[model samples]
Target: MTWNWDQPDWPKFSYKSEALVPLEQQFLLQSGEFVGACKHMGADDQETLKIELISEEAVKTSEIEGKLLNRDSVQSSLRHQLGLGAERPGIDPAERGISEMMVDLYRNFGDSLDDATMFTWHRMLLSGDREIGAIGGYRTHAEPMQVVSGPDYKRSVHFEAPPASRMNDEMTRFIAWFNDTSPGGKTPLPPLTRAGIAHLYFVCIHPFEDGNGRIGRALAEKSLAQNLNRPSLIALAYTIERKRKDYYAALERNNKELEITAWLTYFASTILEAQRNTIARVDFFVAKAKFYETFRDQLNGRQEKVIARMFKEGIDGFKGGLSADNYITIGKTSRATATRDLQDLVEKGALTRTGELRHTRYHLSLAIQSTA
Candidate 1:
């Protein structure tokens, strides 16, 4: 017999609870850290802080964007969360993989991403593996569902299975309810808060055999962008990855309990923590730009143009970092010329290239002092 989690029907999750105190404290501490990082630092050019900000910026954007999927992207996402560097994949496939999917989904619907889109994103995350789900095109599965804690590790926990042949119907109903019931399903809860809940709920549904976790997170991002009314931003997969074990436990707690008060509260709090971090990252870049601008008179024409493009596009253009193509476009020069200009900037400490060849992307080099 299966050992199910506790499900108490006594109290419905609302506003008040001593359970939320720890969450509040946790969020408060995170908010303070965010403020400290963004607010006036003694050293105007805090290179270490700036790098942390850069990595964070990338991580948050990816998370919000719902673009991260796969081992490399997952690792990169975790790396960003852990504040660790080195020992990583060459590139973040999530950005390249999921950003377009998200942007297009928002554009088509004219307001928020729909449930179908969420399922499609799930399919995409699984790279169109038909066996993953029946009707494999965003429709929920047509058969009994299976759960797995780990792919290779068969000994891992498997649970939260939905009844046979009803996964699709029940989930469809839930999606409809979620979209229509809210005062502003897209905006009722804060984006990060909403993200936490969505992630948990989708996982609870357990619609697919493989890629459920990744897809559930993706759905969280799509809803999050809609909720925040900012579809262009990246996902906070990094934040989730940082607290992987905690995140899993939170989910476990959420699934076990019938009432969502504690689950929602904790989820909302983590989201707030993630939110503070993301906003602070934006502030950090603005601060970095301002500090770097003090020596603006030293910059040449092309350098100025690159900076202008950067200012115009903000970080999404290359906040996770810019690409050789982005440099080519931003510099408005030929490939060879763009290459040279990028090289010049690299030497001048304006940019740093990560990965090799076509995988190359140039990002603000926070480490090196900018040359006039």
Candidate 2:
């Protein structure tokens, strides 16, 4: 079967966006609320949120590609890149590379898409990947670039990209199309529609020797940021990673044709969910700040340290709740001190305890107030 790129009118993507109007409206409204919430947050909290979102995207994007990244290392790298602080030394090259790419994307979201920018991102993506034949350039291999799965003897090809020979011309048109469809371009499209199409179009081309999925998602983020006139701060890759099987199926289904209404609808829903998750995260941070303010004078250094460690788990607290051992480990205190601190926290309404003795688990007691 011929791929979408093999069609006569290859790059002319079509979709019925009338049904997506409500989702687009909801996304815009939520985005405004998100921005408003961010503005009200203290400078420190805003910086923390920025780092958190970027770190999450870097980790999740890599996860979607079956690569696991250390979240803490990614955050440290991001801090270094954003000039918030010095990054931890000896970071894995993959983490550093993606963090650099994320920071660049965040800083230059409004810039026009070009070959140089794409190449720079490619170089950053495959910074230490030694297996690839081409690092910062388009694929030039003689064999067809195919997405496949299963054993080699009975491999199933999901999709096949254009030949290496067509890379230059195909990418030239793609860059022009991406730039021209921007908010300030000659033929601007709606935000979600543009972002969705940019992702599908780029991946169909599959211009890179590797890392195309990650880069395609970045393009989608860039498209949304340009349309919004600011950094989107949406956890797009995080959302996509959660339903990755569905994500691949959607892409595979639309690969044989140009019309992508189903893909657009799916992407729009994902964007909305991402916006909601972000809004929740903002609320979580705000609530955390309030919690600290209320208990600032009542808690000692060890209590504060342990609670902060729990907060690091984000909106969802510890998986099985923070055990006494967890408190001892994170707070670096003895059993007696840990017990006293735990009792004190419960008395001060900072923690809620459940079960009995060894079975007991401690949970933070903060309610995330709506930021919208």
Candidate 3:
């Protein structure tokens, strides 16, 4: 029945320095490259990229916990927070709440970690969920909390957090380590490695009745942002979502041991992969700049919007190229208008058409090959 926190050496988490060195180097290199790439972007483009990255993180982090949020709603909320635009429809209280938390974390990345901050984040995360009842700070109930899978008849517990009675004390210790910047303190740990440890520690603490996973992930991101001294361009949540099986397995495997070398290795590797994925986005930004310069005046507003979205989102933005239906949706034009606009793009050499008649799809022409 003993969990990781029950170990005699609990809270003294350690990792293999040799294993983490290369991973750490790769992460720092990729992160620096992303930052350098971002520096070349204009202010507006930088803001757009920020919105895209944060929105993806917000949506994917919730998705990991089986909560599917509307990406548009989340994006709209974020845009409103960043003062980029007015709020859009479909932004429920939950969406707004998540947006506020995300924006706060990014904007105040260097704020000292404290109990008040943690409680505020928890309250915001569950603000309008009546079923979850009052967001009365952390869980104080003595009931056991376990992360389980499957039906009750055949449920399996993947991890068990420390008892509720131990949460406050545990968190105090964690916050001290988090805020300590002295060289002799926890600063010897690489920033990214420290971030990984913070993630595992917070999740193990499981302080809240709900939303612990999301909050933990946010804390991890905050750690990275504070360390990097900038808003994060890399979204580790996206990589975790893509490799969810390994993500959960890493957690479960480490939950049973005091030494967290495996978890640290997995965490570093995931971050490195996330940063590598972001490099493609950096290239896309460069490509987009060239694309706009070459064809900005050739396309109408609708075509410009669609092409910009395709360029920013890359391959995952649309599958099999842009279709009339998708164009209609994204461009907010009638079917006939969308078709006409698409045809105009084709004629202008901004798009290339495939298939025949109703089956046709439009892809960016040689003038702008998609980098996503």
Candidate 4:
């Protein structure tokens, strides 16, 4: 559909490529990258990726659960309120690939990333993945084609997908333009804001079938990389999954009316939130790093294990931090053994008690990441 901005239902950003400029695009990217880079460092890169990927998958699952209630809030909201017990088989298998592919981008294209690389990432993102269906394996082989899930599966049909025959040329154009045009020729575009627009436009193009959402998300990550000059661990997907309701609704709203201001705001807000979340995660990791650095020699295997688990799980304070009961469960010891371990930990000064009796909780006597 050739977009006619005058139409009532047309999106707010209903203009062609000629309108948006390079200066604005570059500026957005540069600003977004600065914050993103600061938020991007810390943690063993591998462990960080693993934790973040799990977090994203958890968010994805929560969003799917949210979608069952309503597609609007389900897609747009970024907070995951669901407690444990949420699961989705449709998504489980794909999580590993998402994680692996993203990390691979860091390994393979960290220095030289761009649009074609983004397309290649999307290809890896969807390829051989049953969740995304047919669009999974190949670039568009034909034009005038409708993107649909298997006929048997009545989900995800993008009638807007370009004709199969034209897909190659269309994608080529998009990739080329994506690489070269920030505001097309002389007009500048900010990198930060460009990420938001590029993301929307890519999904608007709806180049694939079942994997559009996933691919769109990956595209967002790649955009961040280009903006920041490195792959970031913020898990913007996690933030979206957390706020699944608002995410879907915002996209739907934009897709139907072509008004992207709301979606752009949503995307920007999520990017900011993802950055904040990563900062929190990094802080937690930094604390863990300090704990090990400062007291590695003082801790025993059990203490080391306990501290590792606490940081890994982001546990702050606990009453009787490691109670006999928790020791029984986590340490796999009997009440007697658990009690003995707790007493030992207390004696070692690694743990301290609150109340004299059952009310007692344990905390680190020395600061985990204390400036003092």
| Superposed model 2: Cα runs more than 4 Å off | 328-340, 354-359
Residues 1-372, model 3: lDDT tens digits? 678888898888877778888887877787778877778788888878778788888888888988888888999999999888899976788788888899999888788888888888877778888876438477877778899989999998888888888888998988898887422355646767888899999899898899998998898888777777776667688889988998998998898777888888888888777777676666665666776788867888888788878875553556777778889888999998987888778887777899987788887654322232
Candidate topping TM-score? 2
RMSD of each: 11.9, 2.1, 3.4, 9.8
215-262 in candidate 1: lDDT tens per residue?
A: 665566566555434432332555666566787677666565555666
TM-score of 4: 0.62
Q: Per-prediction count of colliding residue pairs? A: 14, 0, 0, 65
Worst 10 residues of 4 by lDDT: 75-84
lDDT of predicted model 1: 0.53
lDDT of 4 by residue, 3-55 (tens): 22224653235433333344345435544654554354454544544444445
Q: Estimate each model's TM-score.
A: 0.53, 0.93, 0.86, 0.62
Sort the candidates on lDDT, descending order. Answer: 2, 3, 1, 4
- Residue 120 lDDT in candidate 3: 86
